[model samples]
Target: MSRTVSFTQMKDGTREEYELLRDLEKPFLRLTADRVLEELRRQEHVTLEGYKVTRLEHGLQSATRAERDGADIDWVVAALLHDIGDGLAPQNHDRMSAEVIRPFVRWDVAWVVEHHGIFQMLYYAHHYGWDRNARDRFRDHPCFDSCAAFCERWDQASFDPDYDSLPLSHFEPMVREVFGRPAYAPEVIREGHVSPLGA
Candidate 1:
C-alpha cells in the first residue's frame, strides 16, 4: 500500500506527516491545468438557460476577442475563465472564478474577475428594476475602468452563436502556461500594478 498520514486529527499530526502530505500534493498541484481544462469542457454542455451559446463558446469568444484586441496572456486567460464559477456558484460566480485564477494571474486581473459581475449589471440590471449604475460605486477603484471595459468588450459581447470563436485547443497552451507558474508569486501577482485592458 502507498504511504499515508498517521494522524487521526489535525492537532495530532507530526511534522513528518505534514511534510509527507505536502510532498505528495506536488503531483496533484501540477495537474491543476488539466483539472481546469476538464471544467471548461464540462461547460461545453452547460448553457445559461436561454443564452444563444454554451458557456464554453462564450468563454472562447471572449478569449478570442481579447486576443484579437492585442491583450497579453494574463488578460486573455482572464477573459476566457472569468465566468467559470457559474457552474457551482451562480449568484457569486464572479468571486469564485476570481479565486480560481487569483494565484496564477495579476492582481488587477483577479480583481477584475472578482468584480465583473457588478460591472456587468450595467447591461441588464435596470431591466430587473435594479440600478444599472451600481458599478459606479467602484468608480474610485483602480481596476474599475478595466472591469468595465472587460465587460463591455468581452463578456457582454460574447453571447452570439454566430461569432467565430477560436477553439479551446487554441487556448489550452495559454491556460497551461499560466497555471504552471508558482502559485502566488509576488512578481506574478504585481499587487498594485494596474495593467490596461489591451496591449
Candidate 2:
C-alpha cells in the first residue's frame, strides 16, 4: 500500500492543489516521485572535505538507513529533509524547513526535521554529562522525544559542516520519506525514545 501526504489548500472547504506521495497506509498515492527524485538529485552542495556531496547525498544516506529499517517513503523523505532549514538563519532553520516543506511534505516529516536540532541538543546534553532527567528537562518541547528517536535511528552522519553536520538544503525530499515511514510513533517516542544525552 502507498501513503499520501494530506493537506487542505484552503481552509474554507475550498479546492486546492497539493503534492501526492505514498505511505504504508495507502499504496496508490498520486505523486510525482520521479520528479521529486530528479529535483533532489540535482541539488549542489559540498561537504567540509570540499567534496561535492550535494543535498542528494545526505538524503540518500538517511533514506538508506530508514529503508533498511523497514521505513516507508515519508519517513525516508523526512530523513532526507531533516537538514533543509540551514538555508535560513541559524536560529530559524527548523522553522524554515517546516515552513518550506509544509506545502509538499507530510506534517510529521516537517515536524521531525524542524525539530531535529532539539534532538541534537539532547544528544549533546547527554553526551556532555546531562542525565536522562536533566536532558528531558532541557529538551523542553513537544517534539523532543520524536526528534530524538529520529536522530537515533533515521538521521545519518552529516557530512556537511557548513550546515553543522546536517544542512537545511538536505531536507527537501526527506520530509516526504520520513513522514511516510517512521521508526517510532508518538506514543513510543513518549515512552521509550528519551536517551539521556550520553548515558
Model 2: number of backbone collisions: 39
Q: Which residue pairs show collisions in model 1?
A: none
How close to the true structure is residue 187 of candidate 1, measured as C-alpha lDDT? 99
Question: lDDT: which candidate is best?
Answer: 1
What tens-digit string does per-residue lDDT give for candidate 2 at 63-148? 66666666655566556655555544557766775664554544555667776765566445666675534435436665566666
Error of 1 at 96 (Å): 0.5
What is the C-alpha lDDT profile of model 1 across 1-199, one tens digit per residue?
A: 2369877899998888888899999999999999999999999998879888999999999999999999999999999999999999999999999999999999999999999999999899989999999999999999998998999999999999999999999999999999999999999999999997786
RMSD of model 2, in Å?
Answer: 10.4
Worst 10 residues of 1 by lDDT: 1-10
